[model samples]
Each structure stands twice: as structure tokens, then as C-alpha cells.
Target: MTAFEATRAWAEAQDAADPLRAFRDEFHIPAHAGADTLYFCGNSLGLQPKGVRAAIEAELSDWAELAVEAHFRGRLPWMHYHEYVRDAMAEVVGARPHEVVAMNSLGANLHLMMVSFYRPTAERSAILMEAGAFPTDRYALESQVRFHGFDPSRDLIELQPDGPGGTLSMTAIERAIAEHGHRVALILLPGVQYRTGQVFDLEAIVRLGHAQGCVVGFDLAHAVGNLPLALHDAGPDFAVWCTYKYLNAGPGAVAGAFVHERHARADLPRFAGWWGHDKSTRFQMGPHFSPTPGADGWQLSNPPILALAPLRASLNVFTRSGMARLVEKSRRLTAYLDWLIRTRLDDTLDIVTPDDPTQRGAQLSIRVRAGRDAGRSLFEHLERHGVIGDWREPDVIRLSPVPLYNRYADCFGAVEAIEAWVR
Candidate 1:
């Protein structure tokens, strides 16, 4: 990588050279003061894909034309709507098609996965996860622990971070697992830590958790679309993610899950529904339940086609651009943002996301040097100036330059806004 220059010309040149630069037009960047805002909030809700409107309209047309028949009629029939997204989504997450399924919201899918994976024995009845996990994950885990007739205080092991910037060290994780191996029934962690933008070692975590007789899983809300994942090869028992972030899908888009091929045939206990029954025999309406093989078996209800339409459109963009290329661009884009922040705003900001590019996705969580009130003021200033990043409570301002749409010049513009505020 060349030394980053803190100039608009340098930023434009970088953008000119970006192979993924054209992808920026695929999204509908929000307006501020009659121009496109420098959108740095893809880590939260992604900007809507331009194709999303057409995708949903197509479904709406079919609904009007065919009514209930739209399920089997239409350009993308509702009967198999989830299938339309399965392959592209699998490629995005680096999993086998059968191992993945588009389904309910993140929290609902987490609970469903827990129902099957969090089987606790009397001897080994604890759940292990990183401390300060996303509140939804903590809530799901705590509820699961209680549902299993165990005390969450006794059974939930929240591993504290020992690394800089509150990042978890693999050493600390291994040590925690080693100490609690006997009591741990499941290990749930994030593919990327939401607050700090720290990327966890999924493969290593899976290996360690399995060694400790734990069923491993991940909440990839921050990882999916932001990071290139190999969920099947990484070998977690399962993983879940919402499509709303980094995917360019609309808000509250249908979520996805991965259940490894190893469990495709396992007789695990699950909360079953009509949608999960064997497809060939699904409409047979038999008394006995026979599950569809692989992750499809976990579906509690049919997919919501309207919510899934935008995902289909967004995944199509991903399919065309490719995850590997997007990630390549992501590393460079984030590095540029990191450089701009450190070099230009070092006096006013402190980056909490790791300096190592491999340890993070696109997000850089920055804290203000002047303290929380100052940070909030700076954040408001950025917002006022049309730099759309997000403020996580206390002091951090998260800026994620999504590769699919964010430009290097956007990064430059954002830092310039910060520098303007500093001046």
C-alpha cells in the first residue's frame, strides 16, 4: 500500500483507481443540502440498493395480476422466493447452499438455533460468549439459559477482553474455554464485535469450542457482507445474520442462517413448523414431522417475499461485484479512512478499532480526545455537514466506508468535516 496523502486530489486518484468504484452508483445515497451525503453508516442500516424498488414492484405486480396464484406464478414465485437468494447468499458467506437459509429476523433465528444447539446436560450446562455482546444476543442467551432450568448468572460466562481497545485476545478466549470447558454446553460469539469493530477468529473459536465439547455459533450481523466469511469451512455449528447492514438491503430485511452439513441429518431437538417439513411431503399434512434436510429444516414459517425482494436485488449486486473483490476494496477503503483519521484528526480523536486491518472489517470506532460531550458535539457537527456516520453511546463515533458504495473521496470528505470542526 502506498503512503496515504491527506488531500482531496489523492482521494480522487484513489477513487479513480478503485475497480469497485462503479458499484457506488448501485445504491441510493441519501441527500444533504442538495448533494449526496458521504454515507458512512453502512455498519448500521445500509443505503438502499437502487434496484430494490424494481424488485419489490415486480412482486407487487405479480400479486395484483395473479393474487394467490403469485405463489407459483410471477417472475420470482413466492413459493420458492427464498431459493432465489440461497446461492448468492451462500457465496457471500462462503458456505454450501444447503448449509444456508434465508429466514426470520436475527433475534428469532438466534433463538431457533439455540433451541437446537444449546442442549445442556446436567454436568455441562453453561453458555460462553464475549462480554458486551450485542444486547439482543445477550438477551437470547440469558433467556435460553433460563429456559433450560439453569441460572444465567451461574451458566453465562462473559469472557472479558485483555487486548488493547477492548478487543478480545485468542489467548484470553482459549484460557476462558479451558477453565469453563467442563461446564460449557455452547459457545456463542460475534463474527465481528459490533461496538469496537473487532473481527473475531471464527475458525480458531470453532476449533477451541469443539475441543471443549461446546456447540459453537456466531452472530454475524456485523460480519456478513462487511467481511468475507467461510462459515462452513470455519465449522461453527450455526451462524445468523440480518441483511439490513452492509448488504444494501432495506431496513429489517429478512435474515439468514447457516447450519453446517454435519448437522443436516442430526436428530437435534428444534422448534418445528410447517415450513420446515420435508418439501416433497410438506403439503401432505401428515401428523408426524419429517424435516427438510440442511438449514431449510430450521425454517419456522415461509419467507416474507416483500422483505426478501430487496435482498435478492442486493445479493445480485454482490454476486456481480464478488465478495473477494469487495473485501479487497474494503481493506483499502478502511485503511484510507484510518489513515485520514490518524493523520488529520489525531489531536481530536482516538481510534478504538484495531490498527491491524486483518482484525477488523470496514468500521473504525473513534473516540474524541476532548471527552464525551465534545465527541457528541463533533458527531453532531459531522451530521450537520452531511457526513452520515453514527454515534454509539459514551464517546465512540463509528464510520464504516462500505466497499459496495462508499468512495475514497467520501472518506476524505468525512475527515475534512472533522478537521473543519476541530479548526
Candidate 2:
């Protein structure tokens, strides 16, 4: 890796040589003071892709011309709208086409996956998850435990970080599963930790949990487009993710789910709905429910064509850029940001995200050393100076340099703004 220099010239040089630099022009950067804001908030909501409007408008045109017939007749036909994005989405997440599907929201998909994979016997009913997981995950686990006639306090195991610098280690994770393996029915974790920006080893987690007779799953909301994943080979029972973050999909876009190919014919219990019925006989109105064999079998209703159009557009961008290339750039881009902070704002800020690039994505969760009030002030200061980053509750401010659209110059400019606030 090249050593980073804390200068705008160095930043511009990196951006000048960046092969992915042209991709930045594809997004609509938010404005501040008559110029584009330094957007480091793709970890929250991604900037709108310039192609999204046309994507949405295409569907609208079909609707106007074809109406109800548009389901089977259109540029991209609504009947199999989810399928339109499946191959590209699978490519992004590293899964087979049949193994991935664009469907319900993240929370809803989590619940549906839990229904099939969280079947608990009296002897093996506990769920092991990381401590301080996102609130939505925590709530879902709690409710699932209660619904199954178990006490969450006793059945839910929150794994803590025992590695150096308060990060979870493979040793710690292995030890936790070993100790709780006998009583654990399921293990759910994030591909990337939301608050700290720690990327877990998905393959290792699957190996550990499966070795212990546990059904493992992942919430990849933070990992999906930010990192290249191999969910198929990693062999998780299931994985769920939202497309709006690093995917550059619009707000509240339809989410996705992945089910391993091994479960294609398994007689697992699932929440049945009409949309999941066998396509060949779906309109026959058969009284019996026969699921569509793969991840698509998990659908509860027909996909929202309009919501999926933007996702289609965004996935096309990802397809064109390729995850491997994007990730390579992400490492360098984030490392530049890290370099700037260490050199310029070390006295006032601390990076909660790991220094090791492999252990994180594009996001760097920064902690203000001057305390919460000072942190809030610093965040607002950055906002005033045309820098856009998100402040998590308490003290951390998340700055993510998305490879698809963010440049090295954005990282440098953002750090400069933070330095000004400190001065």
C-alpha cells in the first residue's frame, strides 16, 4: 500500500489516477453553499443515482400504456420484476441466481428467515448474537425468543469483544459458540457491525456455527454492496440485506434475501403467501401452497415494480463497476481518510473502526475525544462547511467514502473540515 500524504494535491493526484472516478458523476451530490457537499454518508442513505429517474419513469410509461396488462407486457415486465435484478444482485453478493431474491424489507425478511431457521427444541433453543447489535436486530431476536415460549434473558447470548482494541476476535467468537453450542439453536450476526464498522469473517462464522449444529444467518445491510460476499460458498442458512445503503438504491427500496442451495428442496416451515406459490400454476388458484423452490419461495406478495426499478438501475452500476474493483478502491479511499485523521486531527478524534482494511468496509466510525456535546458541535461544524456525515447516538460520527461515487478528494476535504472545527 502507498503511504498517504495529508495534502489536497496528493488527494487530487489519487483521484486523477482513479479508474472509477467517472462513476462519481453518476450520482447527484447534495449541495451546500452553492457547491457539492463532501458526502461521506453512504453508510446511511446513498446519494441518488442519476439513472434512477429514467428507471422509475420507464415503469411509469409501461403503467400508463399497459395498465394491469403491464404485469406481463412491458420493457421489463412486472410479473418477473424481481428476477430482472436477481442475477446482478446475486453477482454483488456472490450467490447463485436462484439463491437470491429481491423481496420484502430487511426487518420483514429477517422475521421470515427466523421462522424457518430458528426452529428450537427444548434442549437447543438459545440464539447467540453479538453484543450491541443494531436495535432492529436486537428487537427481532427478543420477539422471536418470546414467541417461541422462551425467556430472552436466558436464551439470548450476546457475544462480547475480547480481542485487542475492543474488537471481536475469531478466538472469542469460537469460544462463545463452543460454550453455548449445545443450547444454541441459531446464531445471527451482521456481516459488518453497524456502530463500529467492524467486518466479521462470514465464512469463519458459518464454519464455527455449523460445526456446532447451529443454524447461522447474517444481516448484511451494511455489507451487501460495500463488500464482496460469497454467501453461497460461505454457506449460511440465510442472509438478509437492504439495498438503499451502499447499493445506491433509493430510500426504503425493496430488500433482498439469500437461501443456500442446500435448502432448495428441504422440507422447512416458512410463512406461506400467494406470491411464493409455484409460478406455473400460480394463477390456477390452487388451494395448496407449493413454494417456488428457491429464495423466491419466500416472497409474500408480488414485487413493487416501481421500487425495484431504482434498484435495477443501481445494481446495473455495480455490475458495470464490479465489486472486486470497487472494494480495491474502497480500501485505498478509506485508508486515505484514516491517514488524514491520524495526521491532522489525532488530538481531537479517535477512529472506532479498525485500522485493518479487511476488517472494515468504506465506513469509518469516528469518536470525538472531547465528549458528546463537543462531538455534536464538531458534527454540526462539518455540516456547516459542506461536509455530510452522520452522527450516531452518543458520540460517533460515521464517514463513509463510497467507492462507486466518492473520491479521494472527498476524504481529504472532509478531514480538513474536521481539522478546521478543532482549530
Candidate 3:
């Protein structure tokens, strides 16, 4: 029959059998007059988990009763609250407790990382990044380079692909390293290219950069919680990612930093704060800046407990679901979305995300061929009809089927709606 009929049939059957079907109820999906818009923008802001409100209230209650003593009196203890989430975040990023610390915002953490890792000398001062890297990343690197009195045009090396397509081949990246290894001091790439949803080979990039004597770091803004990232195992000198994306932390949640064990003991200098100082003697209010060993030394200030509560709630969801399960469901759900978009939506659509499941996350960036406003029009129309997705730049629309809350039915519903509009 029609695409609508086919999509409905597939959705019904898949929902009946999905193992994660119950999880849909765990989140309060946005609803309109007729239906719940298939929310696919979790790549940007995650759906608030039902437990988040309760978690925050607990912290609020403890503060009301215990005052400053809440630091020592609460069940979780505000005094050592940041540490509570460190181990869980370490697990999420595949880092050791000492290798990962949740702190600061994405750009701030990137700058802090550069202060220690991007120690460009007079001779080797170039910082390498991709041409279409996230605007935040580009700006951060630009500022860091200039902070060291280096010119952006001369000191920053952007390794742009030779073509219009999304990802740069590993060969081209290596070649850039070979040619500029002498001048290059650091290489930064997104774990998943935000605009294209193209996953980079972190281990491979790490190996090549270290071989060239250049320190490597990853901007996992679109990668962490979207896919499995063995940050410590990837062997990058440092990496930073925001939690709001796939981690499902609330808006402007805390970002995390990963520094490989090799640099744990190094005299590499960083812009330090009181929290980064030795926790054991922090109460002593000492004058010396003795940093805590490992990634804990990266913390600049005491994190806000209220901001972290949502992450703690969200991480519990992940703790139960586990990375392996999340990755498996991510592949299948994304594959189903791809299948529906291609198999149902006619020739009017072009998917920029890689077809290889292992080479991408749940996001599929679609470039509509139906003229200039086609993508925007479709996005607005979909929102009107209760099918949510995000539009980027001039023509691309990013639809991320977050496995934690997204379902097979949502995937089918998105394509069915798109098919109706294209008609």
C-alpha cells in the first residue's frame, strides 16, 4: 500500500517487540493536541528524565535543613558531591577515576586543556583542527592560540577535506601530520563530526599524532553518550565533551575532561583553581597550589550540586542500560531511521550520516533536495505535526534517534510525516 500504511505497519510490529519499549514511559515525551512529536533532537538537548526533579529536590531539601553543614550532613554530602559523579562519568567516558573529571563548560574546559596539553613552543606553535569543526571549538582554539601571542592565520592549521563531502579520510589527516608535524603542536578533532555525524577513528588518530610527536585531543561533543568512547584507551593526551548532548544532562550542564595517565604526573601547567588543589588539605586554606593527582587536578572550582543532580539522575538511567546495550540499540534504531528515510521518503532526501553503523552515532543529517527552504519548511511542518527534529545552518536538518527514549515507532512516524509533506 502507501508509505504511510507501510510505516504504520512496521512501527506497530517493532514497538510490540522492542526491548526498550518500556523506557518511553520513563521520559515525559512532548505532546501536542493529537500526538507526541517524535522528539529526535536529543543530540542537542536530551529529554528530562522523570527522576531528575526528585534528585534536585533532595539537594534543595538538604540545603534548607542543614545550611552550610549540608556539605557533611546530606546523605550524598555536598562537600564531596563532585566526587560522587566522577566514577560514574569515568565509566561513561571509559576513563579511570583519576583520568576523568566533570568540570566547567565545553569551551572553558577546552581552553584549560590547551593550557596544559597545547604547550606550543616558539618553533612548534600550530594547532590543527578540521575546517568545519564546531564553531565553539574553532573559537576556543583561536582564542587559545592568540592568548599565547600566536596569530590564528599563521599558527592554527585547519585540515580541510579537499571536497564538499563531510568526513576527511584518515590518509589525508596523516598526510597533514607528516607535512606539518614540525610546526604542529596539537591535533583536535570531534569524536563525531557535529554537522555530518561522521565518527572519527580516535585510536588511529591518536597513534598517528603521537607518532608525529604531536599531542592529540578529541572534542566529543557529538560523541559521548551518543556512542561508545574509550577515551583512556583511545590514548589521546586530552579530550573534552559537554553533557547536554547525549548524556541527557540538563541545559548547559557540566562538561567533562579526560587527560591520559601519561600526563598525570607531568609538570604540565594548567589554569588552576581552589578545587583543583589537593582535596585532603583544601580545608587548610593553604597558599601553595599543590594539585590533586590525575584528572582531579583539572577541576577549577567546586561544581554546583543542583546542576549536577540531573546528570546523576541521567547517569543512573545509563548505569542500568549500560553502554553496550545503549550502543546496540543506537545502531538498530539509527539503522531503522535510515531505512525508513531512504526506503520511504522518495529521492528528495540525501542523508549525510555514514551508512556504516560503526562509523556514526544515532544522528542522521539530512540535506533536502527540494530547494532552499525545503529543510527549514519540513522542520517547521514536522514541528506543527508533532514530529521534532533540529535544523542546522542553511539546509541541513539533524535527526538524532536517542535510543534511551526514542523508539522504533518514533522513527517510523518521522518518515511517515516527511513522506506526507513531500507529497
Candidate 4:
């Protein structure tokens, strides 16, 4: 039978047997023409968990009734609200409770991390990263270098792919480190690349950077909820991530930061704020800046409770689902998508995501080979046909089937839509 003819039956069978099938009901899937859209854009913005509304409403009710007393008397208690999700967030990122803190947005947290970790001297002043990192990371690294009185052009070392439609290789990365190891003060890279969906070897990079006397960190925006990370054991100097994508937190949700325990007590310099001050005596309005120990010390301001409640709701699902199980399903689902795209649409699409499952996450970035406008045309057609995937400028379509809410059937529907569109 043709690819289109067998696709639905196979997908339905897979969905029927999937262990994580129940998770699809936990999220609020968007509808188009009275049917659930094949929502596969979890790498960009996650579908809201059904529990989010009630979670936020509870906070709203507490505020309406308790007013200023909410700080002490609310159900979650505003003063310690950020602490409620600490362990859950830590569990998601494989960090020790003391080493992780849910805090400001991704960019702000990255800047804050640089204040403590990106120290540069005249002798060792270069920062290294893979070329085509997410734009914000590029900006943060460049600004941090410039802020330290170094020229970005000279101090920034970006490792580029050796061939067209390829990703940075570990050999190239290590070679760059060996070449500029002494001058590279900070080595910041993504846990999973934004456009190509390449999962870097964080542990290896950490070991290599430390051996070269460079501080290492990760912008884990794509990796946190999508991959299994052992941040504490992997031993990066620090890491930062946003919760909105795979975490199922709403748009502009509170982000998180991880600082290794080795630096927790170091007399490192940081940009401090009232909330980062010792919580026990914060209400006393002390003139001195005494930071809370561990990653909490990096927090700059009190977090917004409404923004955090959804993260709590999403984390509850993760606590139940377990990372190993989610990752197992993620691998299988992504592999299936890869297989379908190759067998059914290989003539029109090229998968830029790493072919090795171990080197990628849930996303598949497809480069449209049909024509210049073909990628956008197909992406829009998929949307019109109730398949939701995101488009990257020029010629790529990004689709991530989150194990938490996406099903084998959703994957089938997305490819079917693409097939229909191409025809």
C-alpha cells in the first residue's frame, strides 16, 4: 500500500498501545473546525495544562480575600511561593534542590549567571559557543564580553559546522577549545540547538572546558523538559532555561537557573536584589546585601505567583510521568516522525535535526527542498488543515511532539497534512 494509505491505521494502533496516552487529556489542545488540531509545536509554546486555570484562580481567590495578609496567610503564602516549585523544577532538570531556583525570564537569568560565571581577564578573555546559537544567547555572550571591556569579534569564538546542513561536531568543539583553551574564559552553549535540534554532549563539554580552565554553562531552553538532564552530576558551572516550551508553562512564564554546588559558597561577585537577600531577615529591610545560600542567591526579585502557579501545575504532571518514561516515548515518537518524513516526504523535505537520537531532542527541523516559498506555504497549509507546527525563517519547519500531550495519531495527522499539502 502507498504511504498515505497505511499511515492512519499504523498511527492509531501505536496510539492505542502507547503507555503515555492518558497524558494527552491533561492538556488543552486547540481546536480547528471542531476537531483537535495536530499540535506539534511544543518546542516553541506548549499547550496549557488543564489544571492551570484552577491553579491561577486559587491565587486570585487568595488575593481577593487575604489582601496584604496573602504574604503570610494565603494557601501558598506569597513569601515562600517560589520555594513551592523548587523541588519540582529541580527534579525536572536533575538538579539538587539547593542548586536550582525558578526565577526571572531566560535572558535576564543568563545575564545574571554571567555576572558570576563569565569573569574574563586580559589573558583569558574569549567566550566560545557553536555558531547559529539562539539569537538571545549570541546577544548575551556578545554583551557580556563587551561589558567586560573585550571586543566580541576578538573574544567570541563560534564553532561552525564543517559541511552544509550539518551541526558542530564534538571534535571541532574540542579542537577549538584546545586551540583557544587558555584564552577562553567562558564556554557557553545550548543544551539542544534551537534550529537544528542537536543535543550537545554537555558532560563531555564540561570536562573539556574545566580541563582548560574555562567556566562552562548551558542555555537549556530546548533541553530542560524535552531531555533527561543530570545538571548536578553533569557539572556545568551554571545553566539557564525558560519554562514555556516543553515545561507547559504559559507564555512568558518564569524561567530557572542552575548553579553548581561547588560555587554555592564561593565569595563570587553577583548582581543582588532584595529577594536574593537572606529570606529570614528580608522583611527587616537590612542595608546589607546578604544573599541566600545556593542558587536562591541568584534570584533578583520576588517572582509573580500567577506566573508560577501554572509551572506548579505542569510540574505535577512531570512528577507523575517520570523523566525516563517521557524520554523513552520522546525517542520513539521522534524516530517515528523521522521515518515518516523520510519514507513519505523525502523528495520535498530534509530533516536537519541530528540523525542520532542521542544527539537530538523531541524536535525535527525540516528544511524544505521544494522551493524558496515552499516551506512557508506548506507550514501555512498545515495550519489551515489543523496541524500546528512552527516555521523558521528562510526554509525550515519545526515540529516537536511532546510526549506529555502529543500522541502517535497526532504525528500521523501532521505528516498526512504535509502529504496532502505537497500533493
Q: Cα lDDT of all candidates, in order?
A: 0.92, 0.92, 0.86, 0.90
Per-residue alpha-carbon lDDT of candidate 2 for residues 1-423, written as tens digits (9 for 90 to 100): 677888889889999999999999999988888888999999989999999999999999999999999988898889989999999999999999999999989999999999999999899999999998999899999999999999999999999987643568878899999999989999999999898899999999999999999999999999999997999999999999999999978899899999999998788999999999989999999899999999989998999999999999999999899999999999989988998898888888889999988899999998888799999999999988999999988788999999988888898889878878877
If ranked by TM-score, best first, what sequence of candidates would result? 1, 2, 4, 3
The parts of candidate 3 lying over 4 Å away from their true place are 1-6, 162-164
- In candidate 1, position 334 carries an lDDT of 94
Candidates' TM-scores? 0.99, 0.98, 0.96, 0.97
Task: Note the residue pairs that clash in candidate 1.
Answer: none
Summarize candidate 4's per-residue lDDT along 24-83 as a digit string, tens digits. Answer: 899998999999988899999999999999999999999999998998999889999999
Candidate 3 lDDT over 53-151, as tens digits, reads: 999999999999998998888978987888878888888888888998888899999989999989888999999999888899999999989988999
Model 3's TM-score against the true structure: 0.96
Higher-scoring candidate on lDDT, 2 or 4: 2
Off by over 4 Å in 1: none
Task: TM-score winner between 3 and 4, please give it.
Answer: 4
